[model samples]
Structures are given as C-alpha cells and as structure tokens.
Target: MNLFKLFQDIEAVDGDATERLGYYSRRSLLRLGSKALAVSAPTVMASVLNEAYAQSSSVQDVLNYALTLEYLEDDYYQKGNAAANLIPAADKAIFTQIGKHETAHVALLRGALGSAAVAKPAFKYPAATFTDYQTFLLLAQAFEDTGVRAYKGQAGNLLGMDVLTTALQIHSVEARHASEVRRLRGLRGWVSATDEAPAPVYAGEAVTSQAGVDLVALTGKSADRVREAFDEPLDRAAVLAIAQPYL
Candidate 1:
C-alpha cells in the first residue's frame, strides 16, 4: 500500500503497542506481526507523514523540522548502543540515557505539532570517519552544539507564546546536554566556568570558531551572523541533508 496507509496502520496499532511499551522484546514484537504492521512504525510513519502533509504556511513546520532532527539523534544513539563494539562498555549506559532523552524530545515536539507533525524523511551523516572514542565524542559534541544553535535560530519562527516558551525551555536543555557531553570529553569544568569550551552563550556569542562562519556568505551580513559562533544556523534543507543518512 501507499505510505499514508502505512502510517494509519501504525497509529491504529499504537494503543496495543503502548500497552507493551518498556516490556516488549523485539522478537516478541515480531511474533505479533510487528513487521507486517511496521508501516506505522516511528520512522516509517514519520516519512509517510512528511510526504503527505506539508506545513508550508504554519509555525508547525519549524517544530516538525526540529522534531525530525530529534528523531535522527535518538536513532543514532540507539544504533551506537547496539554497536557496543564501537562504544565503551562504561559509556553504553550513558549513551542509552541520552538516547532516551532524545526520544522524549522527539515525542514532545511531535505532540506539540499535533495534527501538523510532518512525515519523517530519510537522513544520513557526513562521511567523516570516527577513529576512536575521542573522535566519537568530538562528533557528538558537534551534533549537540548544532542542535542547540538550531533551536535558538528558529526561536523567532514560533508565533505562539506558549510554543515559544516551550521551545526555549527545550533549547536550554539541549545546551545542557552539549555541556555535559563536552565535560565527559574532558573539554570543560562544570556549568559555572568561563573556559573556552563550547556551550550556548547568549544569542550572538561564538559557538565554535572552526565551523562557526561562512566567510564567503559574509557580504554585509547582520551582526547576528558575524558575532555568533557555531555552524551557521542550518536551514531546513541543510538540516535534512545532515539527517537523511542516519535514516
């Protein structure tokens, strides 16, 4: 069947699935026709909704964009946990907790979007290789930092007061996540320090010097563009490109 039908089927089974949440084994789920009913699975549902529903005119579009990235990060962390060979044994639990948090973030954003939740699109990451734990931490740092800046950059796009406030709240949490991960990597002290580490400063401070600027696009750019650090706020298209590989 078509994608929309698949998502509908997934939602139809959600009541039963929610009852099984936290307890259902992957094998048991398969026994229950999980694969046959998988059209409504999270990623599939997202992809179908993305193609079927277009939020071209609503603030909901931006929220779904953020939700999509959250899904990607959530999935990536889970994959990392499964590939236990790549992640340290001691750190697997840490990664699992982070994955759960990312899942919660995605669910929250998706709920906020309500009827406007977009379908999930395919996503991927850069070809850059991660050589070791240090490299993985570095990349995690980059992803977390990007997430923080993205939320901040889109804060203005939210029109509802409640929506704006909620988004900002999540934005702050993302910054905290970035900070904690950075500390784990031995980059900084606790949140009170003034070290050269990367955490969300006020809107216009440096994010990261290396990926922070687009010098070629600097023809009379606003103060916001020149002063802030981190990779320039990734527009939806750029965000999708970074996300598609992981899907």
Candidate 2:
C-alpha cells in the first residue's frame, strides 16, 4: 500500500492540510490554551526513530507508530461505514465521528513526519470481521482499546513536551472511542478481569497499587473498580502483536 498516496487523497478531499490535520494544525497548536507551545520540527529523522525502542528516543518513532494506528482505524471505520445496512441509523453518527478523528490523526502524524514517515502497511481484515453490526462493533472496541493502551505504552518515548502533549490529547480521544464502542456492545466502558481476548490487552490493569500505595487498601475500592479507574499500557511488542493481524 502506498501510504503517501492515501494521505494525498485525504488531503485532496479535505482541502487545506491544516484543517485535515485537526488538533496538530498550526492554528490549533496556538489554540491549545498555551501560546508558547508549537511543533518546531518538520521531520524527526529516521535514525532517531530506529533507536526509539532502545529506551530514550525522539518524537518521530512515536508519531510514526501512532500514524500507522490511525491509518488502520480510519480504514476500518471507513469500511464499516460504507457497508450497506451494517450500522444502525442511530449509531451511524458515532462511526462517522470516529472515522473523522482517525483521518485527522493520520494527517497530523504524516504532516509531522514529513519525509521520514513509514509507508502504510497492507491491511487485511478477516473475512467475517465486518459482516454484521455486532461483529464490527466488537472489532472496533478491540482496536480502540488497543490503541489507547498502545499510546500509553509509548508515552515515555516521546522527547518533546509539545509532542507528548499532542499524544496525550490523542490518547484521551482514543479512550473515549473505546468507551463509546463498549457502550454500543452493551458492555462496561472499562475492561474487566473476565474479559477474554487472544492477547493480554488488559494485563496487569487490575493492580490497585501506585507509588507503594494500594488503592484497595487505601480507599476500600474493589479490585475491578480500581482496574476500571486506570488503564494499563501495552509495550511496543504487545501492541505490534495485537495489530499484526490487521496489517
């Protein structure tokens, strides 16, 4: 898949690149309630990205990984939205909004990378992945939840404050998407211990400790409630494993 060409098509349909990029736009950066913040660099360089998993790193790798996820999400939602009689009338707007957010995320990450961006991988969804509304919602929940954890795992890799801030903003949005999808599935907004999946997306999330303080001991909260209170991060390897099937 020619990732650049796909981005170009989105740009063509959306007009101005800034608008297409959403929150990462220059104007939006200034409007982030802090006039001093801005993304000064255009391209974050391939070498920096190559060393991303080695502990300390640049924003390039994080943005590139995020962009890839955005691409997958955008394509998934677009396909789901396009499938005739697949989505309910009331739920159509939800998918539309989520699709727009994913598209904007793609534009933002691509614009940030400039020439250093990775090419979009050829995505292959399962034959029955989107055959019906329930199937589509389940997949959507998985993707959004995985995306939320993926971003959280990479948060420590971002070097720039501005970049980290942007990533957090996007992360919050993904969490919201996950919640929305879960609600559509008639499930709780957060993952429970009983939640079953091929991968450990919610692994270690049930712990109630932080900085040596146990929430269950401190606040008398149930383990499940504590788990729901905070979502765990998934390392790069885990995220890639979860995402590999789609790509």
Candidate with maximal TM-score: 2
Model 2: clashing residue pairs? Answer: none
Q: For model 2, what is the error of residue 27's alpha carbon versus the real structure, in angstroms, after optimal superposition?
A: 36
How many clashing residue pairs are found in candidate 1? 19
Query: 1-247, model 1: which lDDT tens digit per residue?
Result: 4845544433332323223332343434465475566654565444434533332224556777788778767766665666646677877777777778888988887776566687666655545323366666766766676677678778766544356777778777777777777888886522223333333322224332335555436546544444432333545555554444456
What tens digits encode model 2's per-residue C-alpha lDDT throughout 1-247?
5646744543432233324244344444455444334333323222222232232224556778888999999999988989988898999899999999999999888877777678877788988767777778878988999999999998886534456778899999999999898888888887766454544666656667877888888889798887788888998888888888888
- Taken over the whole model, the C-alpha lDDT of each candidate is 0.58, 0.74
Worst 10 residues of 2 by lDDT: 44-53
Give the best candidate by lDDT.
2
**Model 2, which residues run further than 4 Å from truth?**
1-57
Task: State the local distance difference test value for candidate 2.
Answer: 0.74
How do all models score by TM-score?
0.55, 0.75
